[model samples]
Target: MTKTITAVGFNFDEKQSEMIEKKLQRVSYAEEHIIDLIVRVKHEKEYSFDIVANFRWGVQANVKAEDFDFGAALNKVMDVLDQKIKKEKEKVQQH
Candidate 1:
């Protein structure tokens, strides 16, 4: 069961939201376990992206990154999230 993601940002529109979704799909994760995805975006000197992935199985991962470019920030956060998800998945499996 894939949870709906809430992407909130400062000065954002539909296109930006779609961009975020597409970026998410670019990564490989077992998203069906995700209970919620809260994405916070901001521009404080540079583009900042944060993702909070809450799993229904009680695994939550939070990642934040900043870069000069929006795509870079997004990529960095996703990479962190991916690593976190992998670790959580392995932990769950070991249980």
Candidate 2:
């Protein structure tokens, strides 16, 4: 799979980028396909985290969360993505 994790709308340090990449990679278990992930962290009054996973199958999933802690927001977003992927996997399997 062509996997890429990118951060937009905010600056991410190397360590934070690596952490997000690793976490996302662990959640990605799809077969041969092009997968592009966009991770956006927006900080205004509160921090907003948005993750978008796009696949060649035309399956697109987005997770969003807001939190004071960046790591916590990332974790929440990842969990939401994990659940969405699992649901999609089941749907594909059933078809």
Candidate 3:
């Protein structure tokens, strides 16, 4: 699985990009089932981070969050995605 991150209204330095990759990698359940991670960041009034986690077997999770800080927004969105990923993992285990 791979993560694709695109940012608008800001340029992501290598360090910042690596930080995002690291954060996404921290999700264990998402690592196993997720096939593609599409991250779109928009910097309007506030920093908006949108994440699309595309998992295997046609399952997917989408989360959007906004904050003055990019890291905060990213963390928020990732938290929601983690919950969704965990639920999907449990669903598979039950079957």
Candidate 4:
């Protein structure tokens, strides 16, 4: 069965929240097995974002980034998480 992926937005306006949700949906594929995702955004002089991706196996991957805008920070965090997940999968395959 395909896993359920949930994306949460914190301190985000309607437009930003919708944008983030759509961006996350791009990664919500069957092979990812991401059961849930908690996306927290903090806006200040410097924006900060934290993404917690929960897997069915109880493995939670987290990524954080800071930038001038919350959306940019979120994108950076997503990029990091993408690489992190890829590396983790490679490790698992090698074992």
Q: Against the true structure, candidate 2 has what lDDT? A: 0.74
Colliding pairs, model 1:
none
Off by over 4 Å in 3: none
Q: Let me know the TM-score candidate 1 reaches against the reference structure.
A: 0.80
**TM-score of each prediction:** 0.80, 0.79, 0.87, 0.72
Candidate 3 TM-score versus the reference? 0.87
lDDT of 4 by residue, 1-95 (tens): 23223334335568876777677666655245666667666665677777777766667788889999767777888788788667666766686
Better of 2 and 4 by lDDT: 2
Off by over 4 Å in 1: 1-9, 13-15
Model 3 residue 59 CA deviation (Å) reads 1.4
Q: Model 3, range 33-95, lDDT digits (tens) per residue?
A: 889888998987888988888878787788888899878888898888788888988998898
Candidate ranking (lDDT, best to worst): 3, 1, 2, 4
lDDT at position 22, candidate 2 = 77
Error of 3 at 52 (Å): 0.7
lDDT of candidate 3 vs native? 0.83
Which has the better lDDT: candidate 1, or candidate 4? 1
lDDT for 1 (candidate 4): 23
Q: What ranking of all candidate models by TM-score puts the best one first? A: 3, 1, 2, 4
How do the residues 1-95 of candidate 1 rate in per-residue lDDT, one tens digit apiece? 34344444457677767778888885435766677777778776888887788887977788999998877888889889888888888888898
